[model samples]
Structure formats: structure tokens, C-alpha cells
Target: MRGALGVFIVRPNPDAGWSLSDADNGEVLVFESGGQAERLAMALARQAHATHGAGEVWVYDRLDRIVGRWRVAAVGMALADVDETAKAA
Candidate 1:
């Protein structure tokens, strides 16, 4: 919500299976389970360029259910192309 970044909401299901929502772009839907939150968060980071922004990921789990969310750094990094030197800089 602060800036442009990928978002994913994971929900568990018994019949249809886990639900993956790409709230940021809303252009894709992937069905998966087991560590779904981690997967989605990684995907979001890849798309949102988290490594560049020093972006960190947080996972929300309740009752053994995973719901992933992406958080981008407001300052520090700008989500640009990440490099070792850049990170060190």
C-alpha cells in the first residue's frame, strides 16, 4: 500500500485446496500448498524487486495456516537492480 509492490493472500481449503490471490497485479493465479506463504512471498519479492529495496518479507500464520504479505522499504533501497556492491553501498 505504501508503494508499488506484489501482494499475495494465501488461504487454506479442503476441497478446492489452497487459494492464492495476487492482489497487487491480479493477473495470475497459482494453486499450491505446503509452504505456500513462503513461495508466494518469494514470487512477490522476485516481481517487486525486494532484494533491491532491502525489502523484507513477513509471514502471517494462524492455526497452522499461512497467509503471506509483501513489505517494501520506503527508503534506503529503491527496488532497483540489486548488486553486491549496491547492497554494500
Candidate 2:
């Protein structure tokens, strides 16, 4: 969250399905499944990294637990690692 050019979050919607939100832009998208939401979030993060430099994607479970994470670096590389130490602020 410190140096990210763009941050996206994927979480469950209150009503139904999953929701993907662009933390930087305040844009939201809904998907029928968590997998679909997560996939789109990663794709958007990759595009943001390619365009602006760095990006991050955070995926949360139904209980609001951080389940997955991806960080796209400025060097056009990405790391799909789930850092257990990362906490939502």
C-alpha cells in the first residue's frame, strides 16, 4: 500500500457474488464467483503495472481474511505470493 501505483481488492459482496474494487480509483465490479473476480483484479493490476509502473491485487475470503496477493513491480515483473504478514489497514 505504500508504493503501489494502483491497488485493487477482491472480496465477497454483501448481497451476493464477489466484488472487485479499485482502491485508487473507487471503481467497483461484480462477478458471479470469487475466482472470476480475482482473475479480473489480477488482470487489471497487470495492466496498471504495465502502464503506470507498480500495482497490487489483494483477494479476501468470505470472512474477510486475506487469501491471496499479487504485486506487480515497475520492472514489468509480478509476484503472486501471499504474504501472511500483510494486514489490511
Candidate 3:
């Protein structure tokens, strides 16, 4: 069995955003920033990896054309990045 999580661009107009969806579910999430979409994709990818052992995450434009993708090979990168700050005062 194979599952895929996709992040698609929505509202091709000036207010363009991204949409996240799955082949198994109808639920969708829309975000105003690509970072948000990527974040969600990363989360989904990680979940899929842990649960299914294999899966795919994709990013598409408003035209439904694939623009980017992350598969099992890149699952490691799917994990969210941590931020660090230092005080020198």
C-alpha cells in the first residue's frame, strides 16, 4: 500500500496560498505561506514514515503541475528544523 501527501498551490491570484491534502482523505488545509505548507508536508512525511514506512510528499502549482517532492529517501529532512538564539549582551 502506498500513500501520498500533497501540498498544492491555491488561488493563483495575488492572494495565492498553498493547500495540503491526502489521497485517502478529503480534508484539506490551506496556508498563506509556502513555509507553512512545507512544514505540514514534513510532518505528514514523518508520520507516514513512522506508520507506513514509505510515502511521498509533493508540492504543486495552481495548475496542478508538480513543482517539488520528497519521498522516503528524504524522510530525514522531513523532520522540522530547530531554531537557536544567543544573547551576547
Name the best candidate (by lDDT): 2
List lDDT for all candidates, in order: 0.46, 0.77, 0.52
Tell me which residue pairs clash in candidate 3: none
**Candidate 3 C-alpha lDDT tens digits along 51-84:** 7676556555566455555554552744211121
Q: Per-residue alpha-carbon lDDT of model 1 for 13-64, expressed as tens digits?
A: 4565555555456553446663764566556665565445433333334453
After TM-score superposition, the amount by which residue 8's alpha carbon in candidate 3 deviates from its true location, in angstroms, is 9.0
TM-score of 3: 0.61
Sort the candidates on lDDT, descending order: 2, 3, 1
The list of candidate 2 runs beyond 4 A from truth reads 1-4, 73-85
Selected candidate, larger lDDT, 1 vs 2 = 2
RMSD of each candidate relative to the true structure? 10.2, 3.1, 11.8
TM-score of each: 0.40, 0.78, 0.61
